[model samples]
Target: MEYSEKKALAIKEYFAGGTTSTKLGLKYGFGNASVSRWVAMEKKKKRKFEEYAASIRAVREGMPTDVKALQEELRMARLNISLLEAMIDISDDQHGTDIRKKAGTRRS
Candidate 1:
């Protein structure tokens, strides 16, 4: 992983637990003071992410159920789910066919 990604993951792990910055720095191979900076940067990124997510939720939740916006979202979700199910079914069918072919080949 890149240094930034590693640092971000470390910061996330630290915040999700009760670990100290010093301990995190030692474990993550960063300077003790760098841990504080990384944590702050991660917090800013998280705040921005949360804000964007909240806005999206608001747009979805505030829409009337009968409105086109809501209908479109529902339609999209249903389509996506259908596509995923179809893909899974195809994969399972292929796997089963392969297994049956292998079994027949072994018997012969």
Candidate 2:
């Protein structure tokens, strides 16, 4: 049976008042496992909502310093990659080494 919003609210209220899932399910006319599953789903939704709210609060407080740190790290990584590519090019030119690719293959 589809649970109406009112029924769901009543069940939640009953659950909050220390009612067991088995008791609530019997009272609500559903299986105990269904009540337990609904409660578990609600808990997961509540946690996800709290997490999103926290992230929103963090953004509102400031641009989240960790994000700035990560952006800086990414920029540094790109620069390092470019420098490494240049070094590889120079090494290949100077030593005639195929360090940039596997042996017997032209792809780099």
Candidate 3:
């Protein structure tokens, strides 16, 4: 189900009023994890709106873009993606599980 920001804030406020996540989630017909995530977001004091960290413009003035070159690059990117996905599939078959970027397993 889709949750609204207003509902999230209300849930957060309910949490602030000493209500547990599980209880609030049950009352609101959502999972406790969702309630906790909402609370965490509310606790983080940051800008309400999202803004780009870098320029939104694709290319700068006086820099011309080539259509054929761009198309070739896109084709190469798609091929690379397919290759990576196949590799992952093979690795999963060999390992019996996804070994790439396993949760809670960090490289030392």
- All candidates: CA RMSD (Å): 18.5, 9.4, 23.0
| lDDT value, candidate 3, whole model | 0.71
- Native-to-model Cα distance after best TM-score fit, residue 24 in candidate 3, in Å: 0.5
Residue 46's lDDT in candidate 3: 34
Better of 1 and 2 by TM-score: 2
Residue-level lDDT of model 2, residues 1-108, one tens digit each, is 357864686467655777787887777777878777888888889999999999999887776687788999999999999999999999999999867657677656
Residues 17-86 of candidate 1 have per-residue lDDT tens digits of: 8888888888878887998887887789989999999999998887765597778999999999999878
What's the candidate order when arranged by decreasing TM-score? Answer: 2, 1, 3
* lDDT (Cα) of model 2: 0.81
- Measured by TM-score, how close is model 1 to the native structure? 0.48
Clashing pairs in 3: none
Best by lDDT: 1
> Distance from true position, residue 82, model 1, in Å?
39
Residue 21's lDDT within candidate 1 is 86
- Candidate 1 or 3, higher lDDT? 1
* Alpha-carbon deviation at 101 in model 1, angstroms: 71
- Regions of candidate 1 where Cα sits further than 4 Å from its true position: 1-9, 65-108
- Model 1 weakest lDDT span, ten residues long: 97-106
